[model samples]
Every structure is written in C-alpha cells, then in structure tokens.
Target: MKIEILGTGCAKCKKTKEAIEKVLKQTGVEAEVIKVEDIEKIMSYGVMITPAVVIDGDVKLAGKVPDEKDIRKWIAK
Candidate 1:
C-alpha cells in the first residue's frame, strides 16, 4: 500500500506523518510513506488543506491529523 502525507512541512503535517509511521511500525505493516510538499502536486489532489493523508491515490484524511485508530483502519485497506 502507498501512503502519501501531504503538507508543506508544517508542524501538523509532521505530526501526521509521525503518527502514521508509529502506527505502521506498531502494526508491522509494510507500506510506502511519501511526504508531498510540492504545492502543484498537492493541489492536483484537490486538497486545499495541509496535513492530508492519501492512501493508494485516494484522499482519506485532510485538514487535520489522524489518530492511531484511523491510521490502522487505513492501512488495513
């Protein structure tokens, strides 16, 4: 599974990426985690907010950080 964390390197975006990584490590899930910082690339995803989470090319969470439960559920897919 491919996970994309979209942000411009802000604190919340960093937190979001860390949270997802923590969950992945705890669950032993092997997936690619990418940090998208390019404005054009991010806007192409139709996300106007930072700290968005995209799983397998689909937008899952946006405008905020996701909890552990949310990360687990997303990785399950």
Candidate 2:
C-alpha cells in the first residue's frame, strides 16, 4: 500500500507520519509512506489543509491528526 502524508512539515504532519508508521508496524503490512511537502503536489490532491493522509493517492483524512484507532481502520481498508 502507498500511504502519503501531505503537509508542509509541521508538527501535525510529523505526527501523521509517525501514526502511519505505527499502523504499518502493527498490521505487518508493507507500505510506502511518503511525505508530500511540495505545495504543487499537495494542491494536486485538492487538499486545502495540511497534515492530510492520502492512501494510494486517495485522500483519507485532512486538516488534523486522526486518532490511532481511526488510522488503523483506514489502513485495514
């Protein structure tokens, strides 16, 4: 799975990245986690907020850090 975290490297963005890593480790699923810091790239996703989670190029969550439980559900899908 390809998990992309889109942000401008803020605290929330970092937390999102870490959360994704934790989920991957717990699920034992191989995933490519990327940090999309470029404005153009993030805009392409049509996300006006930072700290967004994009799974397989699909925006999953945006604007804030989602709970770990919610993240697990997203990854499971």
Per-prediction TM-score to the true structure, in the order listed: 0.97, 0.93
Query: What lDDT does candidate 1 reach at residue 59?
Result: 99
Tens-digit per-residue lDDT, 1-77, candidate 1: 99999999999999999999999999999999999999999999999998999999999989999989989998985
What is the lDDT of every predicted structure here? 0.95, 0.89
Clashing pairs in 1: none
- In the range 1-77, model 2's lDDT, one tens digit per residue, is 89889999999999988988987898897888898899999999999988999998789899999788988888885
lDDT leader:
1
Error of 2 at 70 (Å): 1.5
Runs of candidate 2 exceeding 4 Å displacement: none
Cα misplacement distance, residue 26 of candidate 2 (Å): 1.3
